[model samples]
Target: MDTSLDDLDHDYAASIADRAMRAMAEQRIPPTPTNFAVWFQYFAGSHDDLRNAIDLLIDHNRPFDARINQDLFETYVAPQVSAVVVDTSERLHELMGTAKDFLATAIADNHSQIQAISDVAGQGQAGVDPKALVAQLMNELARAASRATRLEAGFAEKTRELDVIRDSLSKSEQRARTDTLTGLANRRALDEFLRKAQTTAEWGEPLSVLLLDIDHFKTFNDNFGHGVGDQVLRLMAKVLREKVREQDLSARYGGEELIAVLPDTDLAACTEIAERIRRAIAEAKITRRSTGEVLPGITVSIGVARYRVGETVTDLIERCDRALYLAKGGGRNRVVTENELDRAEAAG
Candidate 1:
């Protein structure tokens, strides 16, 4: 067999093994005898072929160390893998420390060599036969200088490349998370905010969500047409962005619905903010193009719900939805609080 062809085959096999390992880790499968046997059977083939493929993959993906693999496996596969991963990680850390010390020593030596060269050049005395000593020093200095220069250049180049990559990634991420039409965060972004809010609530910070729906938006679309409707939506989004705090998130949650996530905000503050937004929407003057006819005013009904310490994202959303329904039922263009509903029911 051709050597290059064999190498390609080996690489392909290794990639397959790596994918399988990743799958097992993600699934949190333990490497117990039974589990291992099942996994092996699932990826059935000649034992030698499988082993060779795995070995090739391991070699190619040198960063996939035992510690990382084991940690992932523990998180996804089995609890026992945690201890092994921890031990391996500790060992790797120790090795890294030793390597760093070695590098530091080498850098110090190079610095000392450069210093000696400078000292010799500065000395005015020419009587002493410093030829042999000077020659040896010069050779050592040249080697160290060349190595240092190359290392610095390589580091700078890598830094520049990384910065370009980071900027590109940031733009891509912003595009993915933003709503193109309204300039607000999209549904996907809202989901991410909800996840983070849940974490914040767990850490004893208050979280609140406000769901706002433009009252009778479909009627506006039907009367004014979609082009004008889109402009109205954009205007609403602008008002929301201005009204919400820096730490808060405002997103277009599909169609005429929008959501705001307030971290470290209580129910009262959220209600006030929602009311302000509602007022802003009602006061905005939206005009039509063809006949110079100004459309009727717009209004939003808002539902406010605060984090109930141990509530899940879904639970919080449902409560807010219920409040929103009540707001719409009671009247359009008003804010409703979940706590208010509880109080009303109690009084009734």
Candidate 2:
């Protein structure tokens, strides 16, 4: 945090983490900040004596501060840098198309359930066992509903797999950046992209970041298992993919936190997109597969903020973060932007 903060403000954790790993590699020492510092300096070639000592230590025995060194490794190790990768519109459409046919079959077989309609258009009579027929109608509807629900989960899983493959194939440089969990761009990637995007924004193009977090995630995870929690994450990811555009960059910023960087976009444009995503997720129903019980559905809180000239990525992120908290504070399942926050502040 000392002098490093000055140069590493862009990505504090990532920079130190990367250096710490390399330092550990060169020194062949256990990962510790003390060992990291000695080797961090050694790799930079700033101190000849320390570098020589580390070099000698690479072949010779050495001692390091165990606690501090361990802390450094735990703190910095680059945090599992993840990459974003996915394609969903195609598969989703296919499943939905197939589901539509299933739904039609269910409805046709159960036409008598409709109070206003006849089993045969003009035939005004439903000639079947009211009990067994009712059971049969329920079975067909349940089957169709189950098919759609299963597809929803499969869609999420396939989307994540596709994302991982896409990044692996075309974005070879980003291979190390892929997150193991969600397959979305990791926090490190988000920071890297912000650094470059900031450079272009300084020239006057609009830039914005939408900070998003899942609502009641903990309650859901606790009520269901972590497996269902993962399902919710994938569900949100698919929604993000559906709503995302060609120029947009979406990333998983740790836990249930996410981000969508929209270059050449303003607050209004960004808010509109956020609302669309909010509504889309709100309307979708996710059912428990183990039991037919309907679990509480998913919702997200979003904070939209546009970049300002001369601001660091940290500042931009912080403002957006504050707005995101505002969205969370006001109520869950809503979008709050810096524009609205500014207005509220001015009035107060």
Candidate 3:
């Protein structure tokens, strides 16, 4: 025996082989020489190697353990382990060839027998021997057929489980990227959008960003309470989404502040979109659905900045934020551009 084989725990192999044989017997499969050969092969080989060999043998209609055990030992094991290695090698080769021929013949015979039985069964004759009928059924359908069915069912179940897992993960991802209060994209989502927008801008596709803040928001919260203030915020988000193009992204940037990312858009287009959003908010009649109490109207001060070549997403956002500050300083309901910032800086 090879040193590796010797090192292997034979007891474990023997136990497994024994259990396998017992299972076969319980299934009423006759313990033939071929079956013993297969069992011996499984016991002597590594688990993975044994499994592969068994699968091949089963496909070839030579799955009986005795047949595998006898063939494997004669063809591979005996030669490697025997004291008279030369003689063992010659004998192993001869026996292996003989086993191959024997298996081919057995398979042909079994096929012929099955065909004959199937023809007889198809005739629908009465008074056929029940045991013979059962044997025919087992040979034709029961053996290995049930295993295939089980494997298919197991695969389908696993597929369903994977789909469910994927759906749960998708929902979790959405929650992580969204603001809970306004049901809009949050800062995390905005950062991702900005990074993508920056890449597009580098590719010669202009990108624009808008930063807008609700005017006098603190006073609304103070006078009408936080609940009404929240209602106003939600309504504003709805209007922003409704007004912005499908390609644009709207996000809530902390309290009373929002941001929009517009891909392939210039400063003028972004300003127009911002104005539309502003007009929508000014015209919207947002009252407490629960209380029917009219809430104070709101307006947004917006800053529009086109992404400059070689500028980072952070730089564009900061410039837009500064422009928004300027808009607030100027009036509170107007749109300010980065050009205005340049003019202001030059004047200063």
Candidate 4:
């Protein structure tokens, strides 16, 4: 007897699962569900990028630690996060169409009842019982009232559904734009806000960008592990949130770099704000929670650049980065501005 397709498929999947688990065991990785999924896909050779990344990690003898595992899952798996928002939006649209169709049906039903009443009122022929006509008209009105009640109930249900979906979409979009570690705006959100600010700048409004970097962030991570490093980042984000105005935006610009977008602010004001941030971070106490040890205070290097009229956002960011490079080169915890960068370049 020929083997059934279902059995063959099951056997294939079982073989892949066995291989995936064995590979994780060999690497001494924990048999977590996330790790299993990643390895299962790896063995299946479904995702090219995921497979290549795993292969590279293997070649380098990198440890499959929790952080690396989470990174792999996010880079390969959780990128479909936006798809949730899109799916929710489509569901919302479908619900609206359902509501529209329901309203149209209700309207048609009411019109038919109104026509029945008109027909009864127009009947002037003899032997037409007036009592019977009145009874029929009352029955029609009662039915119409029932229909109206049903419509109201249906609409209320749909409205509740809409509220739920709207909240979900809002949350999804927020998660997509927010950095999970620092609780600050992520790079994507920063790009969007900066582009909009650039539009405002075109009208001659003042704008400034500050790029702040935690001094010796890699050293912190290397010595204290990612947990302590994360605490330092969170501390920096908190300081930034307190220092900047409500109208401004503070975002994590990848890794240990954080940014603030200041609208209607000139170069001097931006520089002052950067100094304030530097001081605030320097004053904040950093402690390692695991060992209850008080670490040294942390400081940041800041680069400030005022937006130039007719310049692209990229240019502004690049100038700010150059100034940041100067600050880091000069010392680890100072503020530099674009004007100073120009002078430094000229002197060189």
Candidate 5:
């Protein structure tokens, strides 16, 4: 059964990669990383608008680059998050109203019960017939008990509705911040985390970010197919989960790109962590699933950077990315730090 499930996943991924290739060929587009990422989304039916946008761009002979790719993400994925937030907010309002209504009903019911008790007490002491007073008290008690039971039922039903709404909102929020393929935090999540981390880092602890690029990823994708390419990405995510602290976060930044956010960390510690990840990737074996054939394992280039006080999220990300570029330039499968890059240039 496991093997069958694996085959299903393998075939599914292969189909996606195959469709991506077709899209590139059909549009006469270059098989660049940006184009590949875009077409992959197109093939996956992520959004009708994404497909239409790509078609329009191709028709206009526009270049596919980071700007266009980012635009696509902003259009399709980011908006859903906002919509979900608004929808969730509205649901919360309804929940609040329900609670307020319940409170009002409870207060009114209690007041009625109090008034009934006062009337019975007055009648009993003011020379009213005993039989009449007893009957009146019994009626008031039954009314109170009936009201309480009804209110309890209403509370149960209304609270259940609120629970359902809360759950829906939670799932929507998760979807907004999660990468579909790797099940890691998405780029949006990373951006948000960086922003908050920056604030906390100013007064509390240091923050660090790492940018990782799979070495020769395009060639690997072309040779071993997208199934293996996805396998490689998932493996990277797994290592990140295994090695990083619970407080740290790992996310898929984009195609063949991953980000790690570390709180209470410095450059020295982050660099050491990056090196560990690099070495782990180098040492792990990757095998072809279908034939059980041992294939060549892949490595990654990583860049480490520390968040500076008052630095924007973009600034931190760019610094880390620059270090990653330097690592790739220094030769793939190595880790580089922002300080190291600065020192190298100064020495040169």
Candidate 6:
């Protein structure tokens, strides 16, 4: 019998792992190795910087999105990016030096060949054969041309490789700001949009937020499994994408909740947009892939709240969330606005 296995605190380890996973899932974060390690350390209280950053995000009610996860990985878990950058810079410098030397040699060779042709041309046929001189000039020109071609090809290839690297890095960053499940802007992107929108609102531009939650999503998952639930979610996301204007942003606000940030839109206009989205989602249908059977129509409870000047992002979100709660309490599949909630509270 191995005593080491028994000596380990299996329960504690399991507890920590479970907590980490649930936290990730709650935030709609993929359980990639990088994300999992960051979260595990967060729950285990092993890394001070990582824990504090995550705590601040949570305290602010900020969503732990893919971008935030990558930031944490870079800032705390793997801080070797600066070292990698320095190494890359050194390699680039070395490559430049090699290229410079190669070009210098090529230029010197070409110059010498031109000088020989010039000398031959300058000789007034005293001892030079005309055909021989012509042949020598042609050879010099051919060699110079060949060298130039090779140099051009080498540089062209390197430029293509750099372009490919640039594109890959760009795509990776975009993916970090995108939700894997719904193909919408993740919470990090949403938060950034809200900040800009808040600034615009302070300048007298109207902004609004629409928070939507799928009705009875947990029950739907339990009855039809996550696969069908995912289909329902995708359907809802598609509806949102189609219903909103180009300037508006639709994003996954974590499990079963989606949001739209409407810029330059007032409360009345925002409510209209929210109602349209609600209707579209209710009309959308999803089919179960396994059985090839159509599942039930999806419905969402929507909450609309217009931005107030000088309000924090968290405060605006909380007000919108309260409207959503009212919608849920009133009855599922309805749209509620902050003004309506305010009226109700005042009456009470």
RMSD of each: 14.8, 22.0, 26.5, 6.3, 6.7, 7.5
Model 1 RMSD in angstroms: 14.8
Q: Tell me each candidate's TM-score.
A: 0.57, 0.52, 0.61, 0.81, 0.80, 0.70
- Which candidate wins on TM-score? 4
Give the alpha carbon lDDT tens digit for every residue of 248-319 in model 5. Answer: 999988778988999999999999999989999899999888998888889999999998887777888898
Candidate that beats the other on lDDT, 1 or 5, i.e. the better one: 5
Of candidates 6 and 4, the better by TM-score: 4
For residues 243-317, write the lDDT of model 2, one tens digit per residue. Answer: 979768888775678888989998899999999999998998987777867888788999999999998988998
lDDT of each: 0.72, 0.69, 0.72, 0.85, 0.82, 0.81
lDDT of 6 at 105: 78
lDDT of 2 at 309: 94
Model 4: residue 155 alpha-carbon error in angstroms: 1.2
Candidate 4 C-alpha lDDT tens digits along 158-199? 999999898987888898778777788877788899999999
Top candidate on lDDT is 4
Cα lDDT of model 3 overall? 0.72
lDDT of 6 by residue, 1-348 (tens): 111213449987778789999998887665666687778778877677778899899899997754677678757765533454565567667667867877897789878877877787876366778888788788878887888888888877766766765676567668666877789897778989888889889988999999999999878877986667777887888888888899989998877789999999999999998999898878766778888888877789999998898889899999999999999999989999999999988989
Model 4, position 243, has a per-residue lDDT of 91
Candidate order by decreasing TM-score? 4, 5, 6, 3, 1, 2
Error of 3 at 124 (Å): 24
What does the lDDT read for residue 248 in candidate 4?
97
In terms of lDDT, which candidate is stronger, 1 or 4?
4
Which lDDT value does model 4 have at 136? 80
Error of 6 at 83 (Å): 12
Question: How much RMSD separates candidate 2 from the native structure?
Answer: 22.0
